[model samples]
Target: MEDLRIKHVSLELSENQESHRTQGFSSAKLLVVRRGAPFRVSLQLQGRAFNPQTDGLVVRVLLGKLYVTMPVTFSQSGSPSSWRAYISPEGLDPQRLSVFLQAPASAPVGAFRLLLYVLTQSSRRGYKAGRFVLLCNPWCPEDSVFIPFEDQRQEYVQSDSGLLYMGTAMNIVSRPWSFDQYEPEVLEACLSLLQVSPPHMKNSRRDYLQRSNPVYISRVVSAMINSEDDRGVLKGRWSGDFQQGMHPSTWSGSGDILVQWARSGFSPVKYGQCWVFAAVMCTVMRVLGIPCRVVTNFNSAHDTNGNLVIEEFYSETGKKLHHSTDSIWNFHVWVECWMSRADLGAGMEGWQVLDPTPQERSKGVFCCGPAPVRAIRDRRIDLPFDVPFVFAEVNAAVQTVIVRQGQALSFSTDSQRVGVLICTKAVGFPRPQNLTADYKHNKSPNSTLRSRCSSVSEDVSPRTDASHGVSVSLTLDKAPVAGEPVLFAVTVTNTEAVAKVMKEHLDAQAKEYDSSPFDSFWEAHSLIKLAPLEVKALHHQIDPALCEGVAGECLVNLAVVLEDVRTQERVLAFEEFNITSPQLSIQIAGGDSLTPHTKHAAAISFFNPFSVPVSGELTITGAGLIQGKVKYSMSALRPGGRVQQQITFRPNMLGAKMLQASLALSNNTIIRGFKMVSVNDA
Candidate 1:
């Protein structure tokens, strides 16, 4: 911190005509006032051109503690414009004043201005502006210098956070509303065939697992039987051998064959089985209205023998890779779908899971629920632009990209040379149930990943070809084996070789995209927006004529529409705020007559789930505010205190009135509720 300092300042004025006015420090003899002394000061103008009759005047003065003051001034016959002010010792520290005298509207038009003189603890100074020359002369000779105001240039103010800079508008193809609309019928047909029960063959024994999609599961079961018999399409199977398969569908009980099938599909070489099985399952599930898709990745273990494999390391070295050669990880894929209890059976109660091919290895799947996607948009900067390659941007034009199979994407672009790439890696069934939230205080004492982990693993970058502008490549390493961390990286570089590294970095760090008001700072930047509002003194009941006991509740549907104050532009499509008014549990309260005016006290609460604080009015149409103090509190919120109260709404009488509540939030924060409850009115 530095000590406050006051310095002497000065000003000069000139007119468009060849006349000039110079005052302060040159002609005005102003006395310096003491820091704490009582005194008196006055400014008496006397120039003939300073006529209040012809030139109207405005005077402003600043003195010590008095700061600055502006007042209109009228001219006199003897005294041009006189200003008298009494100053106590408190007012004598630093005194300054500004005077503006303009030529009267009735007077002849020309250049006109004002001059101020001051004395203070800092220093003595003079300032001037007007059409008159020095010595109170409006018309001196043409020898004086005059500078035009047009020569001055203005500078723009810049924002510190880089927020003022407008971001590039991303160009995307106008895609259909849902991913299912773009999918081909072939995928579903394939799935349908897979779901059918197999036809009985001559001398073929009946299989026990009868409930499954018999046709598809049976074909797979038959393949296993053939493999076990030492004669198969890909290779002959042998007893107690790694190449053999489990005829799970032929087993009577809930056999472990599924788990075994899952394990068998773990190898990078044999991963095609997993992909095909998953694709078929997804189609079958979708056909059954299960809403399914597949997600692919790599695993590093073998089913028959517990062996380790690393593709990158193995490809380089001449060492013979041990165990059965099956690509389970490279082309790995699994099914994801929203399933009902009837669809998944009794044991699969919570979130849906992948049906293990060999009826085994299903227990190892983790993080399989709906992983809430928190997208943090970041632009790339400081990228090398010298590399030669085709570049294009890809994004799902709709609000969200729903994962599905055989979905055709709409592609549009401005650059003819750049190719748009879309590589459907796999479908993922991320159940929202898998998410668990934990919070640490801002001041917690814990080291980052660098300080905690013994050795850091390097990132493995996937390769892309020259033709594909945006395509995904998968690489599954098997050496480290199962239970080890699997690293995946996706990079997109334009023809200029400028990669969105910063955006990628931000994406890697983002954990959740909370569509809460507490998160958006009242700004409509994200796709999803949620806000909570309150309804007070809700009258709950069923019509007396139709009622038995009090059972029905009054429900109110509310919508919030956000608008940009600056642009006055409304986001018509997705910009909306909605919350249902709390169900008022109205009771009969021992009332038999229809005219009974039963009293009730209730508070309706709403929350904003976006990162920004939202502001809008709540129209209290159904019920008006009663006579009482209005308050706010939060409900069902994460750890950090994230709630605030808006202004209170007090009604004169009990009638219908629009109770409007405006709300806003900080960036990356969410405000949960604005609860409204009325007290004591039946």
Candidate 2:
């Protein structure tokens, strides 16, 4: 072939002339195709034209070391589109060639490179070509073009990982967060989870198929990552009791969980809540080439019965009955897998909800789903695999009953409170996508279901006559910070022409922000008689000592109740505040300059400001900076004690690296310190 040379190359869709590539071999062009779909590539040659029968021209597709070759075909019929014309001897244009390729139904999803070669009865030399990406057809068997681009990015790409914030007031307090899944440990952890096989499954073809199937893989991963099943890897615990006194965030990423599990011989990995389980499952799904994303539902209901109602019994004093059969978490995290559900028939495919939190039983196991999000959105209660259970998580009506001793005092139903904010990582960006409205149906005004209900109503207490009026207002001292006292003031005014007597009650309670009623951290009541148009103010202080036992984040409720002695009418004023723990600062005492394979010393200092002794362990970890974990045992430091600890580590590689040190306090507080290091060969 006299050393075949090429000048330019371009790739366009088989049906259109719109080029996917303009100019360059530096970056490979992409061809998105589904299995059993026709994929064609056009190649233009500017140098020479060779006979197809004598001097064979062929195209090769390569994935890793595996390659498939197809012969270049020619016909008198010109190119299909207006932009592409046939190479003729009379014209001064480039020679044209076309190659058609087919991806079998069993082909894996990944990137494939294309190459062109010419043969003259003996040696085959390189011509010109590029690469294309073959993705699993998410819309196959049925059209699903409505799936948002954000869902596609979150579901398919491993590099774009997600984070689900825990706690009830997450939406109000915690800002949107994302995770780093490109870490080497995270990738390794994902591979390890896939390698784990079910107990009953032998190494048969069905097992192999199950390993590759996203539906089956997601279900297995949901169970295996948690120790609820024998095939599980980590023990699930909601209580904050951890072996190393580590907060859930101290473990870093999903890779940390996987590595710790394997290091413990596949035993439960310390402690994991719902968010950890969902995040780990996302890593596994993305690593195995399945589209997956982590989702967070605030005020998630755990309805015991099939009825879409979460009932709660609260005392007249606003204390929730703990023995209720049904419960609602402040927030719950789970994963959604995108795949075609041939098992459930049409309209059941797309995103399937999979909960790994070991909440309920499904098919004789503790794993939650593969339940279609579409089914939940459509309110299909009759579907199989815990569809009703998931429906209640989002669409359940919450019936709140206020009881005095044993009798019900007041009752109200709220439908919109169950799922306040349903969120996932936004597509193409590292932010939250609120899909709350997607799971909720628009109800007519005449519909029996009420989306929200007030705790107190005018019907419950007779409305005061306009002649004898009263108004109430509540205000906070400031934004509540953890380990600090929160003060609230309630003011009641008599706006009547005549003298009015009022009975005033003030209550301040610290409640779990999710669904259940919380206990009163502090309370005060005062009865006062005010003159006409007279105003009175009452104050309540929630001491830091009272909230010291409250770990992590919680909500403070300040409510004032006033009753007209003569009219028997009540006026209520309420205010809610989200109190968050103060951020702990870890001062890193070291310079940023460093060399590869050199030892570095850094000192971490923290001060104990509380009266009680504090004890915990400090963990230092980094990707390319340190080889493994560096730990320091922190003994009980007395009140007002300042402790400084020195640690040494050796850098394994070189670059701009981040070293993180997390102090997991015994009181369930996580303090973090970060330092950026620049490594040089010198």
lDDT value for candidate 1? 0.22
Cα lDDT of all candidates, in order? 0.22, 0.60
Model 2 lowest lDDT segment of ten: 450-459
- Give the runs in model 2 whose Cα sits over 4 Å from its true position: 1-156, 160-162, 169-203, 240-250, 342-349, 427-431, 442-479, 487-520, 528-540, 551-578, 584-627, 630-661, 672-682
What TM value does model 1 have?
0.19
Q: Which portions of model 1 miss their true places by more than 4 Å?
A: 1-196, 199-277, 306-328, 340-348, 355-682
For residue 168, model 2's alpha carbon misses the true position, in angstroms, by 3.6
Estimate the TM-score of every prediction: 0.19, 0.63
Which pairs clash inside model 2?
150-427, 155-291, 155-292, 227-234, 234-268
Prediction 2 TM-score vs. true:
0.63
